[model samples]
Target: MNRYPTVLTIAGSDSGGGAGIQADLKTIAALGAYGTSAITALTAQNTQGVRAIHPVPPAFLQEQLEAVFEDITVDAVKIGMVNTVEVARVIADMLDRFKPGFVVFDPVMVSTSGSKLIQDETVAVLWQELFPRVDLITPNLDEAEILIGGQIRTPATMKGAAIQMVEKGCRAVLLKGGHLVGSTIYDVLAQSSQEPLILESDYIESRNVHGTGCTLSSAIATYVARGNSLAESIIFAKEYIAGAIRSGADVVTGYGPGPLNHSFSPVSMQIVS
Candidate 1:
């Protein structure tokens, strides 16, 4: 039997539906892939910020993973918002067990509203156990700063930090530069023994920036799941995100930041050999 390229998102459920697993699934589908999810936590969150979080138990989380891996051909996996290090450990163990072909770990450390999402110990396990196990790790400026133990205040520092994350076990790192104050946003993709890829784009003046990171990584996973090379995946995902941002720049969803136009133009599942 034939199948669509499948990508699974292991993440928190966003009640607002603009970010987290919601955004991940939307991004995956929009990018022409079948989307599945194993929700890690429940969040009382909206565009303004995250209010509360309830983590899924480790055993239950494992069951969700098993449910998907047993039946689905997960071509790629996107992981987000695992609150506890134990949960991360469980996810890592399961990944080792199933050997998912491609994995994108989005280290969602803090919310846009300044909420701390991960603890120190959790960070330790995430970096030591999970980062090395995945194909790529996508961290925004703040997350990269935390992971690399330095300031990523400039584009040069951001590239340096991406390389540092590689040294800390990431097979590849996409150190997002959206947080920096600039006219052109430079997202650095650092791979082991490869030249750092500098993805530059003019900043789209849009406050509807919720779930941007989640969407980007999910799109990458989707393209990778569709048999695209990692570099091609990154490039395609970036273009997809830019379109999403531009399409939704003026649309109002909530009182604060709005969701991206993931369905700006629906495309059928892309099957590549």
Candidate 2:
């Protein structure tokens, strides 16, 4: 039997092939996992912006979930771009059933190009039905602002908001500080029982950052599936993304912010006991 840690991505598809299911699968494979997918939406988008989004029917979405879990021993899950409340609730029910080994939720609310990806009603349902199920959530600054109803312009505010996500029932929160203006970026990982862990890195100047959130969360899930501790997974994922950004700094793929070079490197898959 294949012993590689398996990761399933539940997210949208980007026609641009940079930010959604594409990035998740690339990151999962790069991190050395068997990557599966249950696509939640399809966006007609490019590096410039999202032109349109078509959500998979709720029933079909359920079937996709069932098909993956029924056949694969999913070691971890990475969730992203659930665009409706119905989809959100369906995912919750499925999670309760399968109880995957680990779950990383990237609560994608908006696209990098200023497009709304989820409904306003779905926001509340995420806090209610989805928040408690996630092992960790990787939300960018705007997402954190919406979740906490306050501006998170500084590292201090990021810490407070990370705690708020923990209070709301997320097992952990990776509040991304990429959107904040700074010479250094900070991501706070906060959990219910443990003290918060703050990760800092110098910002690498690059416009090719289209699917960073999706990529980071997928890398984390893949690492966790490999049986690495959460802290270690985050650290490793951070290093991977930083290297990706630095490597792709001078390259250009589109007129606007381009996609990361997710296939720049690949690691051997972990054989988990």
Candidate 3:
């Protein structure tokens, strides 16, 4: 019997189903990997905005992690929206213990609508503990600025932030240029051992990009779980996300910004049975 590549997401739940754990699971399944999840928080959210957030206790979060690690051999992990310092500590401990082969972190702080998802205190712990454990971290411009305690206004600044993040112990950093103002979107993939790689794509001007970050990170994890090299995985994930964004361009889900086309095709979930 052939075993399927498995990817796990430890993230918050989005009731809107366009982002967060919902987007992660959809992206993983769409990429032919077995998707699993351990929800860290539950948000009553939609395209309009986040109405409420309920964080799961650290002990319960640990229990969920233990249950998954005990039974399933998780090939890769995509971490998102850790709401508290305790939750961040629990995740850091788990990373140290399990030592998963490939870990992709989306340091989700501010929402697309400009609301903070993680606490200020937890941000420090995330940098000191969880950030160092991941194989790669995917952060938007706003998050990059928060991580470095400065502004990232240009490509040069983004590169500097990525380098600093690598110095902080992450093996590599994928600093997104989506938040920058321009017709062209540039994403930098930098590693300590290699020169920075720039991925430039034409900006798809659409407000329906609710879960692009979560989707991209999850797709990268899925590709890694399927044995793709780091560079290759990120490139493929970018292509997948770009397609999803374009596919869902005009469709509106909620009153505010909508989500991507995670279920755009049946081929999105091509499991190896």
lDDT of each: 0.90, 0.91, 0.90
Clashing pairs in 3: 30-268
Off by over 4 Å in 3: 268-273
In order, how many clashes per candidate? 0, 0, 1
lDDT of 3 by residue, 15-129 (tens): 9998899999988888888988999999999998888999999999999999999898899999999989999999989989998999999999999988889998988898788
- In candidate 2, position 260 carries an lDDT of 80
Deviation from truth (RMSD, Å), model 1: 1.1
Residue-wise lDDT of candidate 2 within 172-250, one digit each (tens)? 8999999887799998989998888788999989989999999999999998888899899999999999998888888
Off by more than 4 A, model 2: none
The sequence of per-residue lDDT tens digits that candidate 1 reaches over residues 175-229 is: 8899888889999999999988888988888998889999999999999998899
Per-model root-mean-square deviation over C-alphas: 1.1, 1.1, 1.4
The CA root-mean-square deviation of candidate 3, after full C-alpha superposition on the true structure, stands at 1.4
**TM-score of every candidate:** 0.97, 0.97, 0.96
Candidate 1 has which clashing residue pairs, if any?
none
